[model samples]
Target: MNNLTARMRHGVIGVLSVALFTLMSSTAATATDELFGGLTSPHEIDLLSHPEIKQDIQTWRTDAGTQVLFVHSPGLPMFDLVLKIDAGSVRDGDTPGLSALTVSMLNEGTKDYNTDEIAELFERHGAKFSTRYEADSVSVSLRSLSAAEHRIPLVELFAEVVGKPALGATQLQRLKGEMLNQLNDDNNWMPFFLKNELYAQLFRGHPYAQPSGGTPEGIAAVTREALHRFHSQTYTPQNMVISLIGDLALEEAKAIAETVSQALPEGPAQPPIASTPEAEPEVLHFERSNAQTDVMLAFPSVTLDDPDYVAMEIASILLGNHPNARLTNELRHKRGLTYGVVATFMPFKAGGSLQIKWDVEPRYNEASQALVSEMLETFLRNGPTQEELDLARQLFRSEALNSISVNALAVRKISAIGFNGRPLDYIQRQQEEAFALTPEAVRLAVNRNLDLKKSVFISVGPEVPQEPLPELLLITQADE
Candidate 1:
């Protein structure tokens, strides 16, 4: 009996030794593989490493004069269709909110489907349909699975909504009421009031000055007939640019393009927007009993098509693109005068504006303004250093690469290019320019674009120093 027990123990010990040896051998193999897995390959594979992946965009025009831009992304079984019309709020000639209201009313109901039914249809197919109205264009976007069963029906529904929206009186009244309510509510928001007022003062009589949301009086005056007229004039094939991306072949893309183009009436293209005139330098003040004051300094800048646009973009980035920007570094980090400060380049089809905005303690409003002016003046005078230029270029390139890595953002980029009448290779060109940009080029662009002396300064808050109000060209009370 003792001998049997000894044999069993020895057997168990032998089994465990074999098992431990196998585990150690497997771990060593794994480590070795991980250390030199790709040594045999010429290069590693990273889908996002190439910035030129989006360079190949196919372009064609339908028989009805609808321009089509298709980017074939077959890896994903999804698709995005965006139709942009050149009729934006700027086209609302006399009426301010007409274009916005008209675009919003598109999905309310069509001749065949009620609003609920329209919503149900899109939801049933797991699709999303939405609209966006900007200064230069209005867009209707539809994202759906690319299966024929799913895509065909969704596209048809989209065509019906855009091509034959029933501008019902009840719906129009409801939308107008909503707009009026929003406008009334916005009055208490000093930022909104100041922005609109500043635009009115800066652009003056230009259409760019007109509020896209429309004033209360303008929204009240918009008639159903006027909506119908605007729709008839703007929602035409000739004025449309259709952008498609995802698991679609060129043939399928062409068919989809026809589905949209053939539904619309072939009408004349929209008229070109006139150039914005030079803005007069002005200081506008709005008084509000708030803890912190909002200040905005705005100046006329270059349009999207301007030669110095890329340079200005680089310059803007260096100035105040983020928390680490020069403006924020000086105003918030160094001085502790304001919590934050930012600068933005608002580019439109006709022209653009460069604006710097900040919020500061009411007591430091004058000091903040002086510091801001000094910083801008210093930047314009000395320009960026070579190290700063290199950093900005790298930052922009990284952002560009990251932005296009997503499918939806890539489609939006393509749509913007088409809407702005930019070359299909515009992004590539910009990337090249950014990489090759120099400090001198950026300085020249800044000098040619931004004019600090002619900028508009707007302050909205309580205790706004009346003593050093930078050459007040206009002053408005908050209650007004």
Candidate 2:
């Protein structure tokens, strides 16, 4: 490695070691004082002084082709296991929500147990089982005591649920009904409507445009056979990534992985999703009866694996990642056009987007939008000051460390490594990159990635005169 790289790594290690030592000594002292004084309440540790846990991931492939990432967290008597499958909403094909429905039904029932029985079994063993579905992946998480009696049964049960979901006709009907109800309910929420519209406009014909839970009509049309077929195709050993973190030994973790992998059917990974098209710059207004106008300015952005992702991330922080961000400072603090404003980057497996969103009074919609546009133009042209860059770096570093502090979040990071096909040290590399970012790098990233002419502006609120907003390209009434 170069001298600079060596110095950076050494600096990080030195800082972390000193912080850890200080925290341990302080904590011990505080506990002793509390014991003598008879204080029952706990004191908060200084978060800034807390050390970041270095990730030590042990990866290997099971005989059945399932990949495993294991981390031994020795102190805690509890463990977390995450099974991530490539079967997310993007894999739903024409039947939007098929992937989600199939994943949701995993714990509902297996060949040996019904939904209630499954729930009872886990609860009886002091274990928790839950599933999460995202755009590109679906994951099931299990938290259980590390004792063999508790962990073994739960692992076996999880394997059964993943390998052989019943997907009964009645269960399918019930879930479909619930999903439809949710879709209907979301229609009345302005943010939900605006988000869906913005995604649809940005992604257009892409699968990302399809809602993960599907529309009411789509949900109503899902059948038991369809769910079963999707399950058979998507929930396979090769398409899954297993992550285990807890007090278990390496051998024990391997055995658990073997059991789960052997239970799954062998199949190839799902095909890659088609790329999303570049967004066309346009303004769309949806008329609702709401008193406040919800506005979203979005543009296409780099993916997580993109070389420029770190720079884009820093640029986003400078824009509005924090309370003191430019958007909040100008739009809320100075102009008082809105209560708050935020800018964020949403990166998917195949694509991503950057969005600035806020709400304003109906009368201030035009002025607020104009101001936002002007600020964005200026920001892109001049870039952020050194102060902004330093603040963004510090905040990003703190947040990154905090994210992995908890067991659950650390487990999720393992899953992200597998799901995104990123390296085990991805988080560490990201921290290094964020700290190394410069003003010129961020400016280049902003100019290269963000194109105002190719962006989309979407607003949902009460109808207003169009003459005041020359940027308006399309106006339509929101669905009732």
Candidate 3:
């Protein structure tokens, strides 16, 4: 009995020893692998080896107009049309929201269809139509199911909206009243006001400074004659792009495209736009009685055409892009000063702006501005770390891959590529550039673009100091 008991105890001990040994061995192996490889880079990626983008590109020009169709798998029984026009806020003249107003009026009423009939037609076809005005382009889009024969009506409606808008007086008056009410709303934050005011300063005589949605005054000033003239000038087949996607045969799609193109007027005269010029840093300020403080600091940067723009984009991402970005980590996570922050490098036709903006608790308003300013100075003096650049590359690569999967996203990308007058492979080119970015390139971008001293600072909060708000940004004082 004693021998048996001793044997049992020894057997139990042996089992426990083996379990501990296995655990330790597994742990050590994992640690060694992580040491050799990376720990923070969650997924192993080879961005240098470009992924295959299998897109069917079609360029067909009928007697009516040119159509570019990028067809992939018809995953769903739905189709989307991105109707892009060359005219945007850049041609709105002194009327800040004329383009937006014109875009809105299209669906309000048309020649063959009244507003109700148009809405009903879209509803019956199981479709929705929308219009948006960007910096240099305006788009009218339609999304409908293929089973409903949506393409025919969708194209016709688009034609009516673009070619023959019935700018009803009632709709215009209602839209103006709504816009005026919004501008008069005292609860609207003042920093937003300052941002638009900065646009006005930067663009000056350029129409690009006008708000995409015109101000109440601008909307009120728009006459029926002006809408008709603008429509006739801007909405031509020559200056438009019809992007069709989902569940349509190549030939059928081409036929539909031709029909839509033929519906547009020929030889529409393009509106004259002032040449976009370099935007210099300007100091601007506006005060408002809000509990939360908002501050915007903007400086001059590159345009869309510059090769350095890619580097600038990487630098901006490193500055304050994601929720876990450097600025957010330091200011929001560590110091607990502000909850919101963003650093964006925005490029236009001629020049661009690198803007860093933050909203903070009223007490930390001054500290937040000072911290951001100091960080900008430090980043400019010394570029991003190797770790930051790698992270930015990974982030950019991930975003590029994700965007390729969506039809709408692809259309938007193609639109930007079209704006650049580049090949459809611009996204891939951008990805390659991002991945190939060197530390020196990052440093150069920082040095050349970031001007902490020359930023236009606009602080809006209840506790703002009583000071003179300049009409134009004082870049010299900012630089000093």
Superposition TM-score, candidate 3 onto the true structure: 0.81
Highest TM-score: which candidate?
Answer: 2
Point out the worst 10-residue segment of candidate 1 by lDDT: 34-43
RMSD of each: 15.5, 10.9, 15.7
* lDDT values for all models: 0.79, 0.80, 0.69
lDDT value for model 3 = 0.69
lDDT tens digits, residue span 1-480, model 3: 233464689899889966864555443343223322322122555655545333455555667655465453355566677778877877788777788778878888887888888989988887878888876789988877765366776777767776777888888777677666655552263544766776676666677576666677787889888887787778788777777766677776676677777777676535444455556556544555677777777776777878788898888788888766788777666655567578888887666778778877666666666677788777777888888888887777666655643455556666566545666666667877877777877888778766665566666667544332223333221242
List TM-score per model, in order: 0.85, 0.86, 0.81
Q: Which stretches of candidate 2 lie over 4 Å from their true place?
A: 1-53, 465-480
lDDT of 1 by residue, 1-480 (tens): 233464689899889966864555443343223322322121333322324423568899998888899887665578899998988989988889998899899889998998889999999999999998877889899999999999999999999899899988999999998878777767667667777887887788898898778877778889999999999999999897999988887999999999989888568998899999889999866788888888988899999989888888888788877666788777766666566777777888898988888888787777777878898898888899987777677666666654554456667888888877889888768877777778888888899889887889898888644444223223222212
| Candidates ranked by TM-score | 2, 1, 3
TM-score of 1: 0.85
Q: Report residue 357 deviation for candidate 1 (angstroms).
A: 1.0
